[model samples]
Target: MLTRTAIYEGTIRDGREEEFFRRVREELEPLWRRFPGVTAVRVQRMQARDEDARPIAMILEMDFPDQATIDACLASPIRPESHAATVEVMKLFDGRFYHLVGAATVLAPAA
Candidate 1:
């Protein structure tokens, strides 16, 4: 199994945080789920960090069977639609994509 993690690093623009999160929950999430070859999608909102200066606002974990699938999904037409949905929320963000990496640990859920 391969996991692709994308960290959307940025702080929500002033006065737009709530709207951004609301759209993520109401709109963007469904679009993310529609991406081809996406086996699983996990969305996380950053709450606290060791450093107060950290600007990361959200982290998204998308799992695929391989890098090829990940690449294909990015190239798919749905990707642009999903990206457009994200852009609606991104108007509230001040940063950019931080990283994209394959997972080093594949952990099983605790029983």
Candidate 2:
């Protein structure tokens, strides 16, 4: 599988944290779930990080079967809709967000 992760490398405005969370769950998630070829959509609300490192408020992961699937999805008409939703969600956040795609491996737990 291929996974794309987007990390928000900044803070949500002081008083807008709660609303930012709400908007992501209510508005942004639905749009992500609708993306073509996306097999899974995961959002991580950061709780802690290294003291010397910059804060990552959230992380979003979207999984697809392969890079070809991801490419097709990005080229599809729905791409613009997703971009528009992202723009709206970013309004409440002050951060630099970027995405990285790579192969995903699932390991079984050892007994």
Candidate 3:
């Protein structure tokens, strides 16, 4: 499996945190779920982080069967739609976002 993770690094505007998250769920999530070949979509809202670490308000993970599927999804028409929606959602945010694609490896628990 391959995962494309979007890291939203920065602070959410004061008093707009709830609205920011709400818009992400209501507006962006639907478009994300529609991406072709997407196996899973996960959104993480930061609750706490190391005091010295850079602030991260959210993280978005989209899983696909492989790199090819991820490429196709990114090349699809839905990509633009999602980008537009993301711009709207970012109005309440105060930082930048970027993506990292990597292979996923799941390990069984040690017995």
Most TM-score-accurate candidate: 3
Give model 1's TM-score versus the native structure: 0.85
Q: Check candidate 1 and list the clashing pairs.
A: 13-92
Q: CA lDDT of 45 in candidate 2? A: 98
| Worst 10-residue lDDT window, candidate 1 | 97-106
For candidate 2, write residues 7-52 as lDDT tens digits: 8888898899999999999888888888898999999999888899
Tell me the RMSD of model 3 versus the true structure: 0.9
**Runs of candidate 1 exceeding 4 Å displacement:** 107-111
Best model per lDDT: 3
Sequence-dependent TM-score of model 3: 0.96
All candidates' TM-scores?
0.85, 0.90, 0.96
The clash count of every prediction, one per candidate, is 1, 0, 0
The segments of candidate 2 whose C-alpha lies over 4 angstroms from its true place after superposition are: 108-111
RMSD of each: 2.7, 1.5, 0.9
lDDT tens digits, residues 14-108, model 3?
99988998899899999999999999999999888997999999999999998889989989999999999899889899999999998867899
Write one digit per residue (lDDT tens) for candidate 1, span 1-111. Answer: 677777888678888888888989998889888889988999988878876566778898888888889889889999889778877777778988754767667589999
